[model samples]
Target chain A: MHIPDGYLGPTTCGIFYVAMLPLWVTAAKIVKKTLRAKQVPMLAIGAAFSFVIMMFNVPIPGGTTGHAVGGALVGILLGPWAGCIAITVALVVQALLFGDGGITAIGANCFNMAFVLPFAGYYIYKAISYNASIDAKRRVIAAGIAGYLALNLAAGLTGFEFGIQPFLHKTASGQALYCPYGLNVALPAMLGEHLLVFGWVEAIVTALVIKYLQKQSPEFLEEGRKN
Target chain B: MSKGNNFIEYSIAGALSFLKESIFADEYATKEGFLQSLDPRIKVITFLLFISAILFTKSITISLCLYAICLALAYFSNVNMWFFLKRTWIFIPIFSLFIAIPAIFNIFTPGEVLFTLKLLGLKLIITQQGLFTAVLFVTRVIASVSFAVLLSITTKHFALLKVLRIFGIPQVFVMTLGMCYRYIYLFLEVVENTYLAIKSRVGTRLHYKKGQQIIAWNISSLWHRSYYLNEAVYNAMLSRGYTGEPALLNDFRVKSKDWVWLFFTTVFFVILLYLNRK
Candidate 1:
């Protein structure tokens, strides 16, 4: 759930950007250390791919359409820093060029899907990979599950920011910062939608991406690949 | 194997190239520039304060004032006006629709209609207050979106991550984000190269139904590879003596200019608040 510009107060919006600054620096250093000249073109293409992939709608169980951020997919293949940068780039372009999300809301959205999800997904994948001694098949399954679950966890955090955050200003006893009912309503809806409708699509996409990289570009698995 | 080794893959490749250069490169450059200047700790705390203020404000006047301040910051940052406009447009429909849909319920429930109309099975009453509330909602959304974009454009993603770590946000979270940034684009390149190949082979009649399936299959494989990649990265980190907590060299220096800028902006917002209250 991308928090639109006005949905959050100015303070919350501004603070998150501030909070995000150090991460941005670390990201830059990581890129500087890691990115090769040959990798640049690939990264650009990946950025474009992000745009194209998000545009295509996948069908859910009911009638609604959904798409994957594919954060983990990218993180798993290229490394999480590149994945974060690529997705943030994609999201910024989408917001600026397409207007799907607001310019002001870009930080929040990036924080949610791009910054949070990919990183979380990467670690989860790593933790699982570390513990297991599975072959390719099982590894792929673990990656897929991790990717899908990570996205939902990211969504949950977004809900917490948008849905539960305002309530924090309210007394702990609940004196109505905005509307308790509204917060109550939004929390479940966000979690439900992500879990049921979008989560499965994400899982499927995550699974497919894991499989592709395993078969085509196994170097991507250098860290987690069990000999 | 990946396809499209050369630039001559697709007829429309030029368009994609242009978009890639204009949108992607410029954004990375911009992100790099803004994030370099501020103290991550200060930035993070300031941002938190701003978010709280924005969420706390319900008054249209206050919201507008906050929005104006955001615009002023954007202008100062030398961010292009058109760039800002273009980004904000995407969310307008969704934002408006989200607010407007709920407002429909507010119409009939208000009892007294400032304006009434006949509609399908329900009254489309627009009370002055309801209308005002609607406008405020939209305004708030716009304000928040604009500010966020400005922040992202100005700041680098790495800086933000470091700030998160420094601020006692969990290490796992920071590590995850770091890894995500490391690899996202490599995955994209794979997809892009594959698509280019697919496009060349499939030709102009290539709106195949199974394209999605192909993409999904590729993504599945990508995930498998990514896990191993993560492990390799971890080893690299370990080899480099990466302890649980990363060491920072204290690169940020708050110049007099930053202090001046921060002070002026804070004062400006305060003035706006005063005016709104008056």
Candidate 2:
């Protein structure tokens, strides 16, 4: 799911960076105003959690293993703003430290995982879980649905980014300069993997985590509400 | 059920080995080497410049040459050659090849047919233009990833975060990054121990459903523990007079050698850009 560099042309990368700059600024402002000094540690720990959560290999049904991106879970636990900031930090570290994602494509990666996934997931979770009792099973169901949908939405945006490359950037001879596949190929390839596999993993992880938190640390869920 | 147990066992092994390799890389960063001797701030800027230059060029030759430069840099930096090659090529290039595979068929990018094959009463043609396009995409990705990996392996993680702070990145963002980097390894150990404990307790052939629940339960417990840990850490910071700003004692000064390195990189980038445009 991490888009490496050279997959998207410079034009696409630049556009995403431009689009994300203001969003990042707004996120920083929101975090500054709402995140208290004590909560600052929570934000840092949340980022750390997102970073290492991928290392936990969850066993799926077909004798295979998968991991959740944890973006939606972060958004549901921390508010969207804090989630955005936390995941952005994780993404940047992955790019710079592990080269898991592209350095130039940091903005694009963050736009999808940080901004789009968290905000969309957070709202979906809020809308579904709204007015439910704190311990309602509906809350867990809402988290599952939100996570599943958020991952698919992010995957769709990523597919569009890859799919548009050939159309928007090509040589005079009509050869693709960057990603060679148009939307017809890129969209299905990205969405298929997520919809069939990773999305469900995310949903299960989110729902189960929410359930456990409800039993153990319900206050963690309430933190996002205060924000 | 037995197969599921094998899958869990193999994945745990895979995850552990991968973590071990990264820990090795972390130790390598502190070793004396060519790239390590350079100022991290300068390294970050020059790497960004090189990456930008790579992105602007459409020529395969220039991209290959840039990739070669990265290999040479890695060699001079004393990074194990096999390790460097494995790190760079194993993930990005292979993944890009899969993405680029469909592009090589005539159905995606139509051009002069290089080869034709008959399968299932349907013709599959590999176009000359399509092959070139795929190679171009893969080479560009390889070059970019190599430089990124080079930067990472050659610099200490904390020093790299400090460099970001020196380059005008927001203090809070840098602090968060620093904290994240520090805590990730610790948490990885916690996770490893948790998995080990689970593995030890289980007799064999753990049900997939049970495995998922256990993993989820561990994650939730980790988060719950982090709540108290965060408060404890913040209080520790308060005792140390941390006022939302982390202080680093390592002062960075631009020595003459750094200037020379910067000048060389700038000239090299200009030359590459010129050749790329031509």
Candidate 3:
């Protein structure tokens, strides 16, 4: 599902990179301001968590194996910013050193998996928590939903981006060349398949991790609590 | 150690050049007519729409045609086309597998043979539909992969996240991405140092047992280290007047250049769509 370069029209890739630039800059600034000497170990652990967890490649019941994105897990343990940065670095290294993703495609892959998923999941968790009426159990549920949905949303974005090229064709024959709604074809099917088959894993993993983080060290999210 | 360092020599140069280009490239230049300066939000939306358009397509001929146009677009960007092609290579193996499976399945399944052979009482038949479906899948996959690459390489990360946030993406997720971007370098620096240290210790013997164990230990230790680091970081934030409301950059205005780019792309897509129908 990770896009390689050249498969998409250049316009699409160029635009995506353009879009990514600002976010990258902002993230850099934030890290510079917030990352102190003490956080180095946590950042390292988050990176290690990302790498080790991904290495396991959770078994999807249909006989295909898909690894945990671990976006929310990292977000829960380390602040989302740390989680996102750690994952992004991990992906970049994986692509460059291991040849896992295309070098050209790194921006898109990073944008989708590293940038989009963790951020989306984090806020979703936050939004749910902010409501005074919500109990811890609800917050946990919200966290679960946010984490699961964020992963799928990232997958959905990939599908949507991939879906863009085919819309250019007009004829029935041309129509044959592309999928009309990338969302329907890729997202729902992929998300649906996961929902029916793998959603539980996503939810469970997310819930358990969030629970542990909250219980073990409530202070980890202390900064986030004020927000 | 030498071998490891040597392996990365080629890539390090490429990375350096890209960094140079990113650092030095003139922000004002419009190499590709006008698409370069579009607001990140508009670009993000447009990119998403473009991807959806491609996904809607299923025909090989259309996919090929669309791919041709994208190639031309890349040329306009003036980024090295070779670099672009190299990036797309990652998808070939995966797509090849995708194409091969259905063809192989067709041969094994007991279907009316469009083409058939009998070997030792086992039938090997390829159905026309199976072959067509496989080809169709390949073209679609190829088209999608290329499209994704096209969007990512040219954009920066910051702009994309802003768009995400503006589009009502949760702050937690947005902050997560921002922090991730901020500190990725910190991790990389650590990894690079670790690699160097490991190389110094295990010069070339590449002792299979020790090397393997070291790799495993690295993974575990890395986790422990990062965990402690997070605790320390949180405490630091507390001392430094850190509240939950993330400090954000001032909002950007969508310049006229951005509108022009958006208009042009929209028009171009509309035209391509019209032509495809014709």
Q: Model 2 scores what on Cα lDDT? A: 0.87
Query: Which stretches of candidate 1 lie above 4 Å from their native place?
Result: A5-65, A69-227, B1-44, B92-94, B101-112, B119-122, B170-176, B204-209, B231-245, B264-278
Error of 3 at B87 (Å): 0.6
Top candidate when judged by lDDT against the true structure:
2
The most accurate candidate by TM-score is 2
Better model by DockQ, 2 or 3? 2
The sequence of per-residue lDDT tens digits that candidate 2 reaches over residues B1-278 is 53455535654675587678778778778888888899889988889988998898878888888899889989888899998888889978998988788789899889999999898999999998899899999999999999998898898878888888766778788888999887877777787777777778785887778887887898898888777899899999999899976766667777788889999999988988787666
> Model 1 over residues B1-278: C-alpha lDDT tens digits?
22222222331353355346345434643643343366655655555445445655656677777778777766665666776666654546354646444443442224235666778877666665455545566666666666555555566556655666566654544454445444544555655566666666765432222444555764544444444454565566667777645555446667776676567656755665565444
Candidate 3 residue lDDT tens string, B178-267? 555444444444544565666666555332223323433443344445556667667766677667555567476788777776787688
lDDT: which is higher, 2 or 3?
A: 2
lDDT of 1 at B90: 54
Candidate DockQ values, in order, are 0.16, 0.73, 0.10
User: How accurate locally, in lDDT, is each candidate?
Assistant: 0.58, 0.87, 0.55
Residue B252 lDDT, candidate 2, scale 0-100: 74
Q: Candidate 3's residue-wise lDDT over A108-193, tens digit each?
A: 77788777878888887877777633236766687788778877777778777766644643243332232333344545655675
lDDT of 1 at B179: 50
True contacts kept of each: 0.21, 0.76, 0.12
**TM-score sort, best first:** 2, 1, 3
**Candidate 1 CAPRI classification by DockQ:** incorrect
